[model samples]
Every structure is written in structure tokens, then in C-alpha cells.
Target: MRIPAFLLAFSVLGGCAGGMSKDECLYADWRAIGYEDGARGASASAVSSHRQACAKKAGITPDMNAYLAGRDAGLREYCQVSNAFSIGARGGRYYGVCTGPEEGAFVTAYQQGNQLFALENDLAHAEHAFAAAEKRLQEINHNIDHAEAALISPATPHLERVDILADLKNLNEEKQRVKRSFGPLRRDIDVAYEELADYRAFLAANGPYPGAHSVTSASY
Candidate 1:
């Protein structure tokens, strides 16, 4: 479920393009905007986006001092290890917002959660590939049946029958190849499942972390 980096960049650019509306800029609370951004773990420089938006839309400049103060307060709410882990578990990108003594612990927890995300992603991919292979095998079998029936039919032309025989041979070979893939694919899925389960158990045993509501409701 992780978003691609390029897509994330595109979303950011898209947001910039749609920036603040004139009404929003006219009535903006820079401190609150800063707080929201900080709580979301955006970099301090994100204020520049607001500045540009307000400037373009309403000819108003953001109050830098108030915004930075609110952002600092908001960062306190966002830079928790528990929040970092939750973000990583959900396949969210970290923007290196946490710093000082907290950064190490935050990064470590995020890495562990990201590992779980990787396992989940791998299992999903394996399952999809297995399903695709099975579907192809079924299609190949169906084609072989039709080819076999055609080859035996009295009305089938001699030249067409020869071509059908060759097609049938190729289909059977491809079916075997597809069948051979099942073992490895299943093994990959099983391994991924086990890894995911183990990680979940490890997190459960070690955590009584703050709940989502508590994390989100924290004061800026």
C-alpha cells in the first residue's frame, strides 16, 4: 500500500497548484495552519507554500513568527516514536521531521513498521502472481482441449489440423511451465505470511502504545 515517491511528489505539487483560496487567505490563521502542518510532520519550509498561496490569492503574507511558533508546538505532538511507528505501518513516508534524541528511536520504530509493510506487500504480490499463473494455466488447458477436438474432427482441413497440433504442443509445454511456478510462488506467500505474523506478534508483545485517537488529539 506504500505510495511511490514520484506520486507523493506529484500530490505535493498538485496541492501547491490548488493552494489556498482567496477567502481562506483573507481569513487565515497562520498559527493554526502551521500547527496542522507540523502535526502532520511537514517540514518547516512548508510555510513557504502557505506564504506563496496567500500572497498570490489575497495579497497577504503569512505571519512567519506565529507560524513557526505553532509549528514547533505541533512538531512536539508529531515527533513521538508511537506516531512514527503508526505512520510507517500504514506505509506513510517520513520526512525527517523528528530530530535530536528522539530521532533515533523514531527511525528505529519506523523501520520496524516499514518491515511489516514490506512483508504484507510481498505476500499480496505473490498471491496475485499465483492467481495470474493459475488463470493462464486454465486458459492454456481450454485451448488445448479445443485444439485436440479440432484435430480429431472429420471436417477439419489437413493443413489446419497440422497447425492445431503444433499449437497444442506449445500449449502443453506452456502449461507445464506455468505449473512449475506454483511451488515457488506458494512458498513465497507462506514465507511472507509467517514473517508478517511474527512481526505483528513482536509488536503486540512490546507495545501498549498510544491509541490513534490519543495520538491525533494531542495538543499542539
Candidate 2:
């Protein structure tokens, strides 16, 4: 899509305790951090992770008031239709950060983008599964062929020949299993492509959501 310079997705690595580094805890800027988090569409509860991180590592606490103020300002920037659209296209989730008209507009756009992203993901995953299954089927068939040849070999022992027969039977079963799985994967790919086409047609007819300027974090 037509992504803008400022609307680019920024990487925000966060996990337990907000995954803040020692340096970030020591040099914490509540306002700036709040702004960044807000821009990234972090939920209000997200601050708790930071709070815990800071408290655990540095024995300090975040400035809640300052952080909230900064977050509000950042949300002002993040609550834009254009940013929401980009976020959705990139398969990003919204945290209900925007309110009022901005909230409705952003969410609407985000959902549209998310639809396309989801379909693309399904298509990719289905394709990958189908390819992997095909490879496995080939391997099983080759092994079965070799086993059959060995079974009839004059040098093969009777007991060993019996084992080979069993192996061949199991291999055939596995091949059947893979073929069964392939059917679904193939179907999934078809469904994904169809849905994608529908979405593309809708977009072409309606155009993208109207763009709006909002402040968002470099990472959101």
C-alpha cells in the first residue's frame, strides 16, 4: 500500500515487566515513554509492566500522571485514519487507544486492512503446508519403492522381508494421510485467494479511507 514516511511501523520489543533494559529503567522518561507507548497503541495497563520492570530492576516507580499526560498527547497523534490503515495492513492490532470520531474512523480503516492481511497470511501458511506435505509424500514414496525392491531381493532374509512389507504398508498409509492434508491446504489457498480478490475489488471501487494526521510512536 501507499505507506508514508512517518506512518512506518516501528519495532517495540516488550514482554514480561515491559522488557525494559537496565538503561531504560535508570534513564526512564515517563512522558516520552508514555508517548511512545501510546503511539504504539499500547493499552493503559501496559504501564504496569513498565512499573514492575522499573521497580524490580531499579527500585523506582513511573510517574503515572506525567505518563498519562504524555500518552494522551501521543494518542492524539496516533488516532488518525491513515495510521490505523497502515497498522492494519501490517497486521497490527489496535488497543482501543482512540476515542470519538477518531476511534471509529481508525478502527474502521484498521479492520479493512486487517482483512487483507489475514487473508494473505492464510494463503502463505496454506502454501507452505502444501509444499511441506508434498515433499514428505515424495520422500515416503521413494522410501517405499526402495523397501519394495529390497523385499524381493534374493539376499533379503524372510524375517527382514516381512518387516519391509510392514514398512511399506505404513508408508502407504502415511502417503494417504499427507494427501488428505494436502486437500485442505489446497482448499485453504483457494479460499484465501478468493477472499483477497474480493477485498481488492472493494478497495478499488471505494478507494482507501480518508487520511488523517495523528501523532504515533516511531515503533507503533
Candidate 3:
């Protein structure tokens, strides 16, 4: 069987990394996993079937450990491919995608994929919270503005003026709390976006992820 030139180079590098040749490591096999740019439209069971089909074509052993590992290795290779484009040169230079070996790459790939997923979920949740908070702040601002307008009127009664002043003070305190929350909330969102963008770049350049995409509910 003829191996790709990239795989040959990967093997040479792997040897320097104190590992087996890329061929022995299954790096090429890992990269061979489809990085579908489009969503898998298939159901979970169907996707599993597709994985089986891929495994068969790749000549991977049927052992569960090896199967799962290969899937993870594929994810890492996909990330590497995606990141290459994201970090590429302005003139359109790109990194060569790895397509060799299988050894320990799967573990790291699977772990990073899972971590990225968790970060994405957290980001989604934070966005919802931020939206709610922003809406509330806008409402408060409107109320405060109306109150200030009333306070400026010559016809404003003493009792009513006192009430408006108190309300303003309370709103200011609430705004301060909201302001404090924004720092952390924004940080969380930023982290999530970074991780997600990395994953997305990987997918765009490489292909679709192995599993399902996350879905967020409107009310969440």
C-alpha cells in the first residue's frame, strides 16, 4: 500500500518525539477520519453505524478501546488541521495536516474535544444570563430617567420628590451590582468563545466533528 508523503514526514518527526513511526502510530489513519464541514443529519444510532463503516474502511481492529481511541485521535488530528488554518499566514500559508499513526494521540484529542464542549456549554449559559441582566438594566435605566424627569418639574410634590430620590439611590446600587457581575460574565463568555472558535476553525478546515452538535434551548 502506498502511504502519503505527509505521513512519511510525520513518522520522521514522531521518531524525534520518542515515538513510533507515523505509520505505526496510526497518525495517517486518524487523519483519515472524516471532518464533515456539514452537520451529520443522521441520528445518533445512524452516526454510530457510520463510525463503524469508517472503522472498517480504515482497517482498525474491532477492539472497543482501539475504536474509541481512534475516534479521539481523529478529533485531535481535526483540531490540528483546523488550528493550522486559524493560525495560518496572512498570505494564505497553511500547515500540513497530520495523517499518520494512532498511538496515544486519541487520549489527548478526546480530552480536548470534551473540554471544548464543556466550555461551549458554559458560554451558552453565560450568554443567557448576560442577556437577562442587560434587559433588566435597560428597564431600570428607563425608570430612573422617567423619575429624574419628574423630579425636575416645578409641580413635583415634596413627598413624591423624596420617593423618586430613594428609588434612584436603590437603582444606582442595583446598577453597581450588575456592573460588577459584567466583568466575570464577560470573561466567561470570552473564554468560551475562544475555545469554541478554535474548535470551529478545526472543523472548518478539517471536517465535521465525530459526535453531535450541542443544542441550546430558547428558555435556557
Candidate 4:
């Protein structure tokens, strides 16, 4: 069996996920590898990368015919609107693998799922920003209290008192600025939650994409 030259030449692996490990490569089944990628809706380009991995690790040559056949079977599992929705919900990228009537429907459903994902992420980001801002506010308040204590101390020098007061002023200004942003952040969170709810309701009414055969670690 002839191995592809590109597989033998490239040793560096990057963005080539779920390729054969050293052990699997030693006893490689290229068809099964292809099937897994197809099932996961991975691009056709994955074959070249996987071939490289197995070649570099175990000096094994892939049977391209078997791998192509397996991938075709796997594509049957991947090409469905329901699977597309799930993939988008989990923030996975689609490679537009399906042809025929299924492609249009799958892309439509996937877009809605992607919208939900975006909203969810936006809400999460806003919440994190707000929490971090609030934490900073608390830290500033704590510092101000300490500075106040130092100012009242009879042993404290005049210059130190002046500096402490100036620090307190700056901290208060920053606190006010953060406080101003809080309302907008809350609004953003609320908007995202509403949009997410709408998308969820839509999918709930419209979906469950087609593949009933679940992919598992054992399959890999």
C-alpha cells in the first residue's frame, strides 16, 4: 500500500484533534478514524492530518479506500438538522458537510442555535464584568476605611494625612464610575437572557435533529 507523501513529511500537529494516539496509530484503523470525524461533522481535510499523525507516530500507512468508505458512512450520521442544532448549541463549528435538501434545513436550525449560544456568552461576559467591578468597588471601600483610620490616628504625620485624603478622593471617583456602569451591565444581562429564552423556546418547539446514534469515547 502506498502512503501519501504529505503524511510522511509533516511531523508537527496543530488543530488536528482526535487523531490516533501512539498506541492507536501502531494498530491503526484509518476507516474508524475517518468515521469518527465524519460522525462529528469534521471537514474532509481531517484525513490528511490524521494520516500524518499515524505516520509520524507509528510509521503506519492509511488505507485510503477503507477510510473514505468509513467516512461516507459517518457522514450519513452527521448530515441532519437535529445534529446541526446540537452542534451549534455546544458552540461547535460546522463544515457544511451535508448536501441535498438537508443542508438548507440544517443551516437554518444551526443559525438559531448559534444565536442562543451568542446570547448566553454575552450574558456570561456581562455578569463577570459586573462581578469584577463590584469586587473592585469593595476593595476600594476597604482601602478608604483603612485610610480613614490612619488619618484619625494622632501619631500620623500631616503630609501622610494629606496623601491619604487624596487617595480616598481618587478611590471614591473610581467607585462612582463603576457604579454608573452597573445599570448598563444589568440591562445588557437582561437583554441577553430574554434573547436566549426566545431562542430556547424556538428550538424546543422546532427541534431534535435526526441522528439517534450517539457518538461515544469507545467509538473513538
Candidate 5:
């Protein structure tokens, strides 16, 4: 059975920083470990990490030739164009593993997917800012209403009424400023949404990678 790209990528990239446990080092399959690391696009220094871990815990050394051979084989699977897009779209980092003829296409797809990732973040930030502004405006309006009521109260103390009047003036000014901010905030949100939509459409039509299906909401 085939694995979903996201899940595969997650498995490859997740929980990869730790050193081998004592048990793991004692009964290690160096080649398999190397293959797993390479499939995740780990740096070449991964073998050094494994060597250090094993030497410290198990008093053993990794088979250098076996590890390199396995890593090379795994890199062939990892450096595919489609995999690059999948990784990049998920905001996963690339380790510069692809080389030779396939490198150009793989890099291109990765960059394209990365663009989509960036656009998604941009839209999210824009929407968040707009929402925050709207909330602040609501709060300002509420404060203004309360201040206005306090200023006009018939039995209010003279000194308190003066303070309330001053507050009302400041609140009105702040409300106007917040109201004016709405225009630019809304424009920012609209522009971000449109830019993200346009990029998504472009990817859908052009395909994120060769032989891949059209981009969809799930792709993000």
C-alpha cells in the first residue's frame, strides 16, 4: 500500500534529532538507520552522530561503507520531484540532498511549493490583524457609549462629570482613529486573500510538479 505524502514526510522528518538509545546502539542495523536518515534528507553528518552514539553507549562502530551505500540508495527515493513539492508545501526543510540531473527539477518544485506555504502564512497574518482591529474597534465603541452616559448623568458629581467629559472626548478621538484604520486593514486582508487565491489557481493549472494532480485545498 502507498503512504500518503504528508504522513510519509512526517515520519521521515519527525523525531530525528535524538541520539540512539543503549539498546538501539547495541543491536543496530547501521544500513537501515542510514537509509532512514537519508530518506529524511538528513545531512551527511548523520552518520557521525550515529557513530558517536554507538561508540559511547555500545562500545561499537558503524559500518561506514554499508551506511553510505544504504544512504545513496535512499537518496534516490527522496530526491524525486514530487517528494520535493510535498516536503516544501508542508514547510519542511530541504538538506540539499538532490544532485546531478534531477536536482534542477526537484529544486524548482520545492521552491514553488514553498511559495504556497509563504502565501498561506501571509493570508493568515492578514486575517488575524483584521480581526484584532475589529475587536479593538468594538471595545472602543463600548467604552465610548459608557463614557457618554456617565458624562450626561443628572446626579453625577461635578468633578466626576468633568473627568467623564474628558474621557468621552479622548474616546471619541480614538474611535475615529480606529474607524479610519478599518479601510487599510480591510484592504490588506483583501490583497492577501487575492494573492493566495491567484497562486493557488496558478498551481492548480500548472501542476505543482510534473505528473502530479492539480493543486487542491488539501495540498496546503
Candidate 6:
């Protein structure tokens, strides 16, 4: 069996805030903190130059705008000490706006970041599910190819060939099962995506939701 030259596997990221997408906002913060220049500090000038030369050989641009955009956005959280975290709610310091010696400061961060984190995790789950489906399909294809090859060969095998034939039938059934599951998986992903889109629209219309349940400060 011949495999297709192009195989499309779906991969997705969270629905970012509509007002100023999380990725773009994160990148802006990274730039504000001077992360780009520091990244090249560990590499010697010649090694960096060689990497650029190799990229050119591969028909890849050293100055990739899109790649840099992702790099900055992905790396921003790591640049800061407490950019994102998870903790229980213990609201006290006016929704923990200012840094205090109390424990509630930690909870405030968690409350503020929870929605974004949940959205991000859901997107990750969707990607993982899609990948698992793709893997199952690949296994089915491989089994089909091997079984077909075994059946046609004029070797002296009898019982083994019969087993291979059986395996081929099983693989066919597995393929149908995978096909059936895909529809439900797609529907679940679509529903999650719709929720994300709604949240994004909400954020855009009204600014980021206040961190705490009660009115905290005029700044937020």
C-alpha cells in the first residue's frame, strides 16, 4: 500500500483574548523585558553565524518573522518569575492587586489566570486526541500493507499466512472503528472552540474580567 504524500493532522491552540490576543500580549511583555538579546548570549558569534549559514543552505531564512513571533510569545512566560501559576482562592488584599506578605497574593494570580489556563489546556487536549487518531490510522495502514505483502508472496508459509489474513480483516474493522470515533471527537472540539470564541468576544467588548468576586480597585 502506498501512503499519501500529504497527511493533514490537526493541531490547535487556545482561543486568545480578543482585545489583544494572549500571544501578542505576551510577546509585547517579552520585548519590554529585553529577552531577545539575552537568548543569543550563550552562543559564540561563530556558532550563531554557522547556524544561520546552515539555515540558508536548507532554504530557510534566518530572519523568520513568524518563527520569531512564536518564539517570543512562547518564551515570555519563562522570562518572568511569576508570570503564571496555580493556587487555591484566598482573596483578601483587595483581590490581591498589590504584592502583600499574606497568602492571598498567590490565589489572586491563580484566579486571574484560571480561565486562560483552562482554555489553553482544552486546546492541548484536542490536539492530543487528533494526534492519537492519526496514529491509529497509521497503524491500520501499516498492518494492511504488511498483510497484503504476505498474502501475495509465493513462500512456503501456510499457518503464518492464514494468521496474516486474519490480521488484515481485523485491521479493516479497526479502520471502521477509527472512522466512527472521529465524528464525535470532531463535534466535541467544535463545541469547545465555540465557547472559546464566545469568551474572546466577551473580553474584547469588556476589558479583562476583574480578578476577584468583589470590587477590588479602580485600576482594574
For lDDT, the strongest prediction is 5
lDDT of each: 0.75, 0.77, 0.50, 0.71, 0.80, 0.47
For residues 1-220, write the lDDT of model 3, one tens digit per residue. Answer: 2223464345334312122233433343332222120011111132354445445555433344444454444435443432332222112222223345532343334444455556567778989988888888898889889889999998999899999999999988998898788888888788878877776566545433233243332211
**Cα lDDT, model 1, residue 138:** 91
* TM-score, model 3 to reference: 0.39
What's the residue-level lDDT of 120 in candidate 2? 75
lDDT of 4 by residue, 2-88 (tens): 222343223123225445688877776767766666776678888878777877887877788988988887777777666676567
Name the candidate that leads on TM-score. 2
Clashes of each: 0, 5, 18, 1, 0, 0
- Model 1 alpha-carbon drift over 4 Å, by segment: 1-17, 208-220
Q: Which digits, one per residue and each the tens of the lDDT, describe model 6 over residues 1-220?
A: 1111121011012111122333344343423212232221111132244234434444332334443453344333322223323211122111232233533544434555466456656766886797799799998998898789889898829888888888889999999999888888887687777766665555444434333233322322
lDDT of 5: 0.80
How close is every model to the real structure, measured as TM-score? 0.78, 0.81, 0.39, 0.80, 0.79, 0.47
lDDT of 1 by residue, 46-148 (tens): 8777888788888998888888887787777778876777677778878898888878888887886677777779888989999999999999989988999
Error (Å) of candidate 4 at residue 52 is 1.7
Clashing pairs in 1: none
Candidate 4 or 6, higher TM-score? 4
Q: Answer with 1 or 4, whichever has the higher lDDT.
A: 1
Clashing pairs in 2: 10-219, 39-217, 77-214, 77-215, 78-215
Q: Order the candidates by lDDT, highest first — what do you get?
A: 5, 2, 1, 4, 3, 6
How much lDDT does candidate 6 score? 0.47
Which residue ranges in model 3 land beyond 4 Å of their true spot?
1-118, 200-220
